[model samples]
Target: MISKNVNSLIKVSILSSLSIFSAPLFATEKTIPELVDAVNGTLDTESREAGKKVKLRNHAKGFCTSGVFKPSAKINNALAIPLFNQAEIGVIARFSLGGTNPHASDKGAGRFMSLKIDGNNESLNFVTTNSQVFFASDIDDFFTFQTKVKQGAEGKQWLIDNKPDAKAFFEHIDQMLPSSSFANSAYFGVNSFLFNTYDNQITAGRWIFEPVEEKSTLSQVQLAHLTDDFLKEELLTRIKAKPAMWNVYIKFAEEGDSIDDPTILWPESRQHLLVGEVIINGSRDDEAATLQCEKSIFNPVQLPKGIAPSADPILNARAPAYIESFIRRL
Candidate 1:
C-alpha cells in the first residue's frame, strides 16, 4: 500500500501541474485586448488566492541561468531564421515550478523552462513546460476550465465528470516522482508554429529540448528528507562541475494533426529534426538577474522572419497576457 506521504506528493504534483492550466482566455475571433483583461483578472485572482505578494503571476518560483545555443550545420540550410543561421546565440534561461504560489514546495512539483536567445539582429523566446500536452485546446475552453477550478469542490467534480483527458493527466502524475535536477528533465513547447525553409518549404512543428544527461528522479522516501529549496541549489552545484546541455529539436506535424489545439498530442511516428544544442556554462542567480527575470516578458508569438505563428488561439493569446503580467508586476 502507498504511504500517506506518497499520496500527498501525488496530490501536490497534480495540482501544481494544473495550477496555471497551460491555456489562455477568450477566442480566436475575440480581440487580444479583451483576452488580456481576462488573463489579468485571472492572475489577480490567483495572487489573491496565494495570500502573498508573489513576484511572478505564474511559475512564481524559479532561478535564472546563462547559456549559449549552437546551431546545427544543417539549420541554416533548412530554415531561414537569422538566429539559427548564426554561429552561437547567447541564452538567458529560467527554470520554474508551475504554480502561482512562490512558496510552493519543490518536491514532486510541476516544472517549466523559459528561454530567451539573443542573436545579431533578432531574438527568439521559448516558453516551455515538462508536460507534453495542455489541459485545454483553446482559450475559450481554458477560460471555462479556469472558472471551474475557481468554483470550488463542485467544479472539480464537474471536471472529472466531463474532461477525460484531464482526469487521465492527473492519474499519470500520481505515479510520477520529482526530478532530481532541472538539468536532466526534458521540456516541451506545447504550442505549434510554422517554420519556413529557405527553399520555401513550410512545416508546422513544436520545439522540444531533450536533456543530454539521463533523467534522475527522487523516490518518495528520499523526497521527504529534502527541503523545498533543494532543486535550485542542486542545479547550481551540478552546473558548477560541468556545463549542462540539451539537444534542441523540432517535432514536425504531418497531415491530419491538430496544429492549433495543444491538448492533442501528435503521434511519435512524426518526424523530428535535429536543430542544435543549448550549453549552460554559467548561472545568473543574483538579485539583479532575478529582478530582470521578473520584469522581462518572454512572449511565445514573438518570432523572427523565418518563423510564423500558427492559428492556435492559446499561442496568440499568450503575448498579451504576458505583457499585462509584466506591467502589473512592475
Candidate 2:
C-alpha cells in the first residue's frame, strides 16, 4: 500500500501540472501590441464575480494585492552579456495564475513566470513556478493531468494510450512524479537547441531558479491587498532597498536520453552548476520607456554557447506556441 505522504505528493504533482495548462499550439502572425490588445480584451471579458485574493510577501514587506501580469519593455543587454553571453535580445514575461478557470485571480495562491530570452542568433523560453516538480510531463500530459482531475483516472489512461509515445511516457510517469512534490520540484526547458556543446543531441533540459529565501507558509491572516500593482510595488520596494539576488542554474539530459519525455528526471548527482546571480538593481527602463521593456519576450532556447536546448517534442511544441503568442502579443 502507498503511504499517505506519497499519495499526497502524487496528487500535488499531477494537479499542479494540469493547472499550468494552455500552451499556444498554433498562433496567428500578429504583432505584439495586437496580441496584447486581444489577450487583455479577453481578460476584460472574463467573469470576475468573486474578488480573487492574491497574496505577495516580500522580505519585511507584508502580503498585498494580486500581482498584475504586465508586458515587459526593457532588454537589459549588459546583464544578458554576463549571464547568457548574448549582446542583445528582445523578451517578454507574462505572469499569471495556473488554472483553467478564466476567472482565476491575479493574486492566486500559486503564480507562474514565463520568460522569453532572445539571443542574437537564437532564442530560449522558460516557464517556471515556485514549486519544483511539474504536474504533467509534456504539453499533452499537461492536458491529461487536467482531464483526469476533471474527468477521472480511467479517462487519463485512455487518452495516454491513444498517443504514440504513451506507454514509454506512462511507464516513466511513476518515476517522473513523486507521490508528493520534490522536497522542492523544479522545471527545465526539457528540450534542446543547436549548440556547440556535443551533448546537445537527443538531450534537452530545463532551468531551475529557487528563491534564496526559505519557505514559510502564509495563512489567510497573512494575506493582504495592494490593489493591482502588488508585484511591482513589492519587487521594486525590495530592489530599491537592497540588492535581491537569485541563484540561476541548469539541469540537462544527454543525447539519446528521452529528449521527448518531458517527465524524465536528470540527476542532481550531476548538480546544476551556478551560472550567475540575477541582481535587480533598478528599473531597466524609464517611466515612459517601460512600455517597450514590458513587450519583449525572453525565450529559453535562445542560447549563446555552452548553454543549449534538447531536441524534445516538448521543445517542438513550445517553439511555435511561444513565437506565435509572442508575435501576436508583442
Candidate 3:
C-alpha cells in the first residue's frame, strides 16, 4: 500500500509533466481577423523601431525584379493547368527579408520570395520562404506563437511551458542559418494547394523553387559586416552579370500525406514533377516600379482555374488577413 505522502508526490509529478505537454492557460480562442491583428500588431511594433517608413505590415522590405517562367513543352500529367500549358509567362518577383522592418539586416534568418505570374486569363501568385515548413500549424497556433515571441524571454518561456509545437518551431528557427544571397537559396511554398486536371481529376501538392546556383550561406562574421540592404544589392549585381534562375517543382501528396499541416514536412520519397524554370533577367530598379510592387498584394490563394487551396486552416485564413492588411495599408 502506498503512503499518503507518496500518493501526493506522484500526483504532483504527473501534473508537472502534463503541464509541460499542454498549451498555456493563457491560450484563448481567436477568430481569423483577431489572429491577423495580433500578428500585424507585433510586426508594426518591430517595423517602427527599425525606421519611420510606411511599409507593409509584413514582409515590408523587399526588392522587385522582372522574370519569365517558361513551362515544359509537355507536362505529361493531367494536373497541368492552363497556366502551366502556356509557352511562357511574365513574372513579377519580389525578394524580401522575412520581417516588417524595412531596415532589417540582410543577414536576418528569414528570407522570402513571392512571384506574381501573368497568365492568359487570370494571374497566379506563389509565395515561398527559405524554410521548408512554417512555424505554426494553424491560425490560432500562429497567433499564440507570434504573441509569445513578441513578449521576449517571458513569451518564449510561455511557449516552452504550454505550446510544445511552438517550442519546437522556435528551436528550428534558432538553428536556421542566414542565406548568402536570394539567388542561391531554395524556397518552399510551405502550404498545400489542389490541382484540378482537365479530366476533372484533382491532386494536392506543394511548390518548391530550387535555385540552379548552388545554395550557400555567409559566415556569421561575414554576415555581420554586410550592409543592411546587402541582399538587394547582391541580387542586383549578380543578375546583371548572369541571369538568376530556379527550377520549379511540385511535390504531390500521397494517400497518407498531411495536406493540412504546414508544420509537417512531407516525406523525401514523395514524387515531384518538374514544371518549368523561372529566369530573373533584370531588376525593377525604378522607384515607381518598386512602389507599385510594394503596394501590390501577393495572394497565395489567387490561383488559376485548375488550382485551388487545400483544407489547410492556415491557407483558408490567409485571404482574409491579406485583405485586411491591404485595406489598412491603402
Q: Per lDDT, what order, best first?
A: 3, 1, 2
Q: Relative to the true structure, how large is the alpha-carbon lDDT of every model?
A: 0.75, 0.41, 0.77
lDDT of model number 1: 0.75
- TM-score, predicted candidate 2 vs. hidden true structure: 0.51
Across 1-330, the per-residue lDDT of candidate 2 in tens digits comes to 446686466546544543333334323233322222222222232321111122111111222111111111222211232235543344333444444344443343454555544455654556665544344445545544444434557755765666534445445444432111111223334443433333233223456655444433333343343342344455556646664334556555454555555555566665353544333334433332234433333445555544455545455444333443333321
Rank all candidate structures by their TM-score, best first, as comma-separated numbers. Answer: 3, 1, 2
For candidate 3, which ten residues in a row score worst on lDDT? 18-27
List candidate 1 segments past 4 Å from native. 1-56, 151-154, 283-291
Q: 1 or 3: which has the higher lDDT? A: 3
**TM-score of predicted model 3?**
0.83
Residue-level error in angstroms, candidate 1, position 217: 1.4
Q: Would you list the clashing residue pairs of candidate 1? A: none
**Position 203, candidate 3: lDDT:** 88
Q: lDDT by residue for model 3 over 98-151, one digit each (tens)?
A: 655677777778889999888788889998998885778866778878777778
**CA lDDT of 198 in candidate 2?**
30
Each prediction's TM-score against the native?
Answer: 0.83, 0.51, 0.83
